[model samples]
Target: MNNKIGDFKLYLSHELGLADNTVMAYLNDINHFYDFFNNKNMQVKSTDIVNYMNKLKSDGYSIETILRRLSGLSAYFDFLIKERLIDKNPISFISKPKGWDKLPKFLNFDEVDKILSIFNTNDPLEYRNKILIEFLYSTGCRVSEILNIKVSDVDSKRGFVRVVGKGNKQRIVPLYNKLVEILPSYYNIRHTYFVKGRDTGYLFLSRNGNKLSRVMCFNILRDACERAGIRKKVSPHTIRHSFATHLLTNGADLRTIQILLGHSNISTTEIYTHITDNKTREILTQFHPRFRNRGKS
Candidate 1:
């Protein structure tokens, strides 16, 4: 826990919306640099970074490994600059590793089923988790979006909920059949939560009755994944990713998914193609009008 690493971690998780694995990797890289000064001295200097990197190189780390570490360290410095904790990014001159981009991680239909089914509806918190996962996957919402939903925002009679997305933009997301079926039962249970605060009216509440935090959302999902025996680094984003990818795999078009995801640019939604390219190719071969007959005799 070097100086401000916790703050930097929060910045990465909440501000940047980084995946849990990426956030942990960045913090680990930054912590490694902090450990370089074995005396636990405070720092943010280019010279120390260079010397520590030199030590890593001398220790025979591969170029890919070195570049990845530097990328994370550079991101830390960039966060420091943004936070105004430092006026300059000490590692500003360094280049990030190329081709390091990863496709967003997603669970297939079966894995998603496992997580959804693992929670017993009899337990209140477990029931909440079940509803939480279903709601996220159904809406394809960001964690921030779903966490902000109030009871008033959902119109169960109409079968859709209003979502407030990035930049305070609001959109309506329909509840899928599975979630719609179980919601009334959840609402019955929800009425019994311990109200520790001023009754914030947020739909997702912690046992303590405060609106559930981003970290709590993460931990709940993580614990659920572990129970389901899913080894992939699962986060709330995984649900969102799975929702979009599964939709595409099942023939939902990118434009519709983009609007559902609240992405400002279709290019942002198009990234799901990287994850579902093979499936899409299958879909195209099976159903595309032009693919039905090519050079047929």
Candidate 2:
């Protein structure tokens, strides 16, 4: 079973082109299933698969986790069928789990303002951190994409920045006027840290002039959030989530947000609608004439 799982991993990587993390997740889920069936000494069937899912629920696994594991099993069964080890995919008959629509965590506009305001200082490092946070909110790029940005990626004249996203795909995201105004200061300070001979084109850099790692970016945002008295866990992704949510609340369409965020599918972009719906409900509850007149009627 372990050798068969290794082959599946290779197929996922070489044939499906899945990311490393995704491949590992699939493997891990399948390994769990394998362990559950190890002592059964019976042919795996749809009933067996259903029992496994029930076990997951009984063990207090989240709906999302159960759904993900089911998906992994589906793929694994398909591979087994292709290799003639299974006559049919047992997972095919199972209805997928539903109603796990948890929205992404995002900071509200005031919270974002508070975090950014904490860096209002003359320190160059503070300026860099401020620019990093601002840029994440402005462009909605993933932290990995942002870290890959070069000084040349900024088009100050045209007010846009080019971002290379997942699958090495590139897209242009518009920069707000505020980001444009701060660009010069960030650039000047960023260049001062450059080694005399090493010309790293990456926009954000470390103290030693190396490209900024994702962990470092998370630390920057976490520190800023702490200083701003925000108790929620904050990272570069929180800023990106805030970017999309704020845009949707301000009336940007889902398609436009999808394009800006470089999402391959609009379904991925629609999560922001949940946030917008909550905002709409808040507005209606607070100021709607019907709500205000309910006591009188």
Candidate 2 lDDT by residue in tens digits, 49-69: 889988999999988788888
Report the Cα RMSD per candidate: 6.5, 3.7
Model 2 worst lDDT window (10 residues):
37-46
TM-score of each: 0.67, 0.79
List runs of model 1 lying over 4 Å from the truth.
Answer: 1-96, 196-198, 282-297
**Deviation from native of the Cα of residue 271 in model 1, angstroms:** 0.8
The TM-score of predicted model 2 comes to 0.79
What's the C-alpha lDDT at position 40 in model 1? 44
lDDT per model, in order? 0.83, 0.85
- Residues 114-197, candidate 1: write the lDDT tens digits: 998899888999999888888899999999889989989998888999997764678999998778888888887887764554
Indicate the worst ten consecutive residues by lDDT in candidate 1.
93-102
Residue 219 Cα positional deviation in candidate 2, in Å, after optimal superposition: 1.5
Once model 2 is optimally superposed onto the true structure by TM-score, how far is the C-alpha of residue 135 displaced, in angstroms? 1.5
- Candidate No. with top lDDT: 2
